[model samples]
Target: MLLKDHVVLITGAGSGLGLGVAQYCKAQGAAVIVTDIATDKIQSLASEFDEQDLLLSCDVTKIADLERCKDAIVQKYARLDAVIGAQGVFDGNLPIQGMSTQHLDQLFDELFNINVKGYLLTAHIFADLLKQSQGALVLTTSTAAYAADGGGAVYTATKGAIRSLIQQLAFEFAPEIRVNGVAPAAIGNSQLKGPKALNLDHQKQSDIPKDAFLNLFQSISLLQELPNAEDYGALYAFLASKQNKVMTGQTLVADQGLLNRAVLTQSH
Candidate 1:
């Protein structure tokens, strides 16, 4: 297995991409520490994991919660091989022209807090442990960073920030730890929700009509199918593994060829 004998931490693993990657890491023989802010999700995950794995209600944006998680990990395994940051929020795809100043202000804070700040805090809190192990940090960005209409303005901006953060962190932590990012195009099972500022928190990317989404996605990219969460698992597993010796300070575009063509040529 790629990650055999490793100890990995996955944040925002209550559902969606985080959940999928956590399971894949476990199957690859890593002792996984899965955390999310949802208490019910944590409770539900308990039965699937033995005492060997740690599950907690961790809010990534809060230092105290992250510190508690770090202490528990250090007490249990004493070493962390990789940290996969998978928590994020969608910006409801509402263009800036449609939003008022108040809407934009609140939306920016909410999305950036969860989507950008969460990764920043996680990296800061866990840097020492990862450095000790000379491990890896795999962050999640999006195809929005490269192309237009991948998300709304705020969401795209947050992703761009993450893409830059990956490079900076990789450079700072170099010769010891690897920092990288995965920018996925379309995840078939994405539960990425929107900001509460515009009252769009109830909306999720996963709620899209499957057939319509598939048809639109298929028409644009060379790869006709929308990749499922598990399909991206192996790539994450590899990046978080010791086998990643050469690559660093980069964001791999796992976009299934979506950005290669004129997918956004007609967008205003």
Candidate 2:
């Protein structure tokens, strides 16, 4: 009941972390509005939630669609207590050398469109409502934000931009609203290993060298299990809760201490 009586609007709610958060919020007593571009996926997902009161078709990359999503939430709930901008994409693992300018440009545009631009637009559109509720924004960045080659040129930049955006939003929004982000390690749910539209298994011939990935896991410490989308829901819930009022403009690392090990001494 951490979020009891609150209204949370989440993007990318069709699947993965977004879907998980929506459900978590609903379970915690929040009226949830789940929005995603994939209508069919979201509809199917909605069935799983059994909360007919939550769900919308929002393409975060499209301003009109985002506006519609926001309007729907305001109409139904009157105000938003929290917003989670979780619509993002990792279009397979392509290295800088292997990537064409066209590929990089297109991917960069799309990633920022959903990740950075989406967050900005959602914040602006919901800021007034959030101010009324003293709400917060929980953005989903990633471990990729901290490393130059964590994802790829495009993904890294997009995540980094999101990291900065969290701080900026927290500063601009001030005491009325809080802003924060979570940086997770590789969650093993990326569409990167799949087809052309990230639907097929392309991991067999991924552009990122296998050794680079192996080295990352080999050096990791803490829990051995792979991180999952559902694991993020609780963290998101906490950040969006009233208990976290003093915590803002910070990025929480929930990667099983992956980054901590990165900088830790071997002796430790």
Candidate 3:
């Protein structure tokens, strides 16, 4: 009952971490609205939840599309309690020199638009409602914010920017709304792996020389085991709950011990 009677909206809820959070929120008694661009997947996931009334198909990169989603949810629930921004894309691994300028430019542009601008749009549209409810905004950032080669250069930049955005927005939105973020370590269940997701199979064939990406994590992470997408849900739930009142403008790193190992290595 951490989110009892609350109305929570989560973007990128079709699959991966977003869907995991949506399910967790629903189980906690929140009236949850799950949204993603993939209509069929959203519908499929919604069927499992038994509450499609709160499901929406949204493309967070587009302000107007997201507005439509917000409007629909408001019409049904009349109030907004919390929002979790988790929609993002990663084109696996390609060295900076191997990556095409066109690919890099387009990917970074879209990445920032979705990862950063999407948060801005959601905050703007939902700020008033969240202010009224004294709700929280939980954004998803990655451990790439701290490590250069954790992901692609562009991917790293986008996550790092999101971390900074969370801090600034927390200050600007002040006592009315609470904003926080989670910076996870290499998550095992990624959309970046499959054909329908980041489509890494074809990507590896095209630009990247390696057969598989994400090998760098093994060497750097002391824990050796990568976290699953579902493993991150509890952190978001905690940040979204009233239990986290005094913790705003902050970030939690769920890296399974990679960061500490990195720090120790640097000191040595």
Candidate 4:
């Protein structure tokens, strides 16, 4: 019951890590507002939610869609206790040299608009509602924010920018609302997709063979096991809970010792 009686709104909750977070929060007694760019995707999970919960179609990059979502949440619940900015796009690790000039601009815009600007807009539009409830904002970052090879230049830059946003927004919203982040490495069964501009919109990380995915992580992580998207749920819950009053402006890394290994190996 970590989130009992809490009302949380999550973006990209149609699949992957966001879906895991939504389910976990609901199981802990929270009323979840799940949103995704694809209406059908959100509708597919309708059976799992009660009437008290909400499922809406939201394109995180659009202010009009966000404003509509905000209005719906306020009308239904009267207040919001937590907001999770989980929408993101990958770069498929496309090397800088490989990208044509035209594709590079589109790729950068696609990734930043969704990954960084989306979170910025979410926080901006919802700041007042969150403040009214003295709530928390939990954002998703990645190990790529701190290390190389997790993504290509564009993806890494966007994640790094998120880390800065977490700190900056936390400072700006302090004493009224708390802000924090979770930085996870690769999830074995994640449905995370790449930008359409890169022709990877249909690509899902989960589509990779299970053994191959596990082997890929096992090669880099000290733990030698791939983490599941569900593994990150509790961390989000903890950060969103009212009981977690002292923590803010920080990102909890859940990379299974990958960063540690990178640091140690580099010291040689």
Candidate 5:
């Protein structure tokens, strides 16, 4: 009941981590608004939500789509308490040396547009609604932003940009709206698609063998247990709720101690 009586919006709720967070938000009693670029993915989520929730097709990079969603939220709930941006793309972890100059340019815009700009646009569009309610805004980053080799160069750069965006946004929106970010590592059941620039859009991270992923995670992670997307919901819920007053302008590293362990192992 952390979000009881609250109205929350979640972007990129089609599948994987975003989908899990949306469900958890609903269970916490928030009138959740779920949106995704994939209409079919959102349609499948309809039954899981009651009338108290809304489902929409949205591309976070598009202002018109977001404006439409805002109108819908106003028509239904009248106010927005929080906005959680979970939309992103992975860069397939291809090394810089492996990529051509042409591929790099294409990937740069593609990943930045979706990974970084999407959050930026959504935050800007929804800022008024959040300020009106004195609510929160939570954007997703990644551990790649903090340490090397967390992802390929382009993907890591995009995530790093988000980390900075959170701080700047919190400063600008202060005394009215709180802004923060979460940087997760090794999320389980992530269907996180790769970049279309690299012709990897048709593939998903989850296509990797479960055992292989788990084994790799265990070797480098101190927790040694891969957390399901829902396991991260409690943190998101709190950050996206009125109960959070002490935290703002920060990105919580929800890496299951992977980075901590990585630093130690690499030091040896």
Candidate 6:
């Protein structure tokens, strides 16, 4: 009940880490507003929430759509306690050499629009509301932000931009709104999709071979196990709660000790 009576807005809440945070926040007594591009993905899960917990169809890249979501939240709750930007698309690890120039351009636009610009727009649209309540902002970044091979160059760059955004915005919004991020690696059974420009929009991380994916994690992670979407929810919840008073402009890396293993092996 750390978030009791809090009003939280979350993007990409239909699946993956976003959905998990929405559920956890709701369970902690927050009025969660869940937004996703795929309405059908959230329909089955809708019954579990109360009527006050809204599930809206939102395209994160569209400013109007985000504005509409903001308006709805204002109309209902009149205040926002937290904003979680979780809408993102992967690159399927397409190497730069493998992509044509035109394909690379399209991929850049698609990924940046959703992964980087989308987070910016969410903060922009909700800034006034958040300031009114002195709310917290938690953005979803990736382990790819710091490590190579987590994704291709483009995906890595976009996540890096997100990490930068969190720090810069924290400095700007401090004393009124706090900003932070969660960077997760190899979330098991994630429904993360790739950009359509690369013809990977239909691709789901869950579609990959489970055993092979697990094996890949085992090869790199000191924990030797993939973290689940729910494993990340508590981090988001804590970042969005009053409990995180002294932290901002920082990212919590939840990568199953992958970075530690990488450094250790390199030293050996």
Model 6 TM-score relative to the real fold: 0.96
The TM-score between candidate 4 and the true structure equals: 0.97
Candidate 3 achieves a global lDDT of 0.77
Candidate 3's displacement at residue 176, Å, is 0.8
Compared with the true structure, what per-residue lDDT tens digits does model 4 show for residues 155-263?
A: 9999999999999999999989999999999786899998899899999888889988888787778887676777789999989989898899999999888887754
Steric clash pairs (candidate 6): none
Q: Give candidate 6 regions above 4 Å deviation.
A: 262-268
Best by TM-score: 5
Clash numbers, per candidate: 0, 3, 0, 0, 0, 0
Ranking by lDDT: 4, 5, 1, 6, 3, 2
Better of 1 and 3 by TM-score: 1
Model 4, global lDDT: 0.92
By summed lDDT, which 10 consecutive residues of candidate 1 come out lowest? Answer: 259-268
Give the candidate order by descending TM-score: 5, 4, 6, 1, 3, 2
RMSD of each: 2.4, 3.9, 4.1, 1.9, 1.5, 1.7
Q: Please give, for residues 6-27, the per-residue lDDT of candidate 5 as tens digits.
A: 9999999889989889889988
> Which lDDT value does model 5 have at 259?
73
* lDDT of each residue in 47-78, candidate 2, tens digit only: 56654367888777677887887787777878
The positional error of residue 190 in candidate 1, measured at the CA in angstroms, is 1.0
What would the TM-score be for candidate 1 when compared with the true structure?
Answer: 0.95
The residue-level lDDT of candidate 4 at 182 comes to: 96
Instruction: Output the worst ten-in-a-row residue range by lDDT, candidate 6.
Output: 259-268
Which clashing pairs does model 4 show? none
* Number of the top-ranking candidate, with lDDT as the measure: 4
Each candidate structure's TM-score, on Cα atoms with residue i matched to residue i, is: 0.95, 0.85, 0.86, 0.97, 0.97, 0.96
Q: What is the alpha-carbon lDDT for the whole of candidate 1?
A: 0.91
Q: In model 3, which residue pairs have backbone atoms overlapping below 3 Å?
A: none
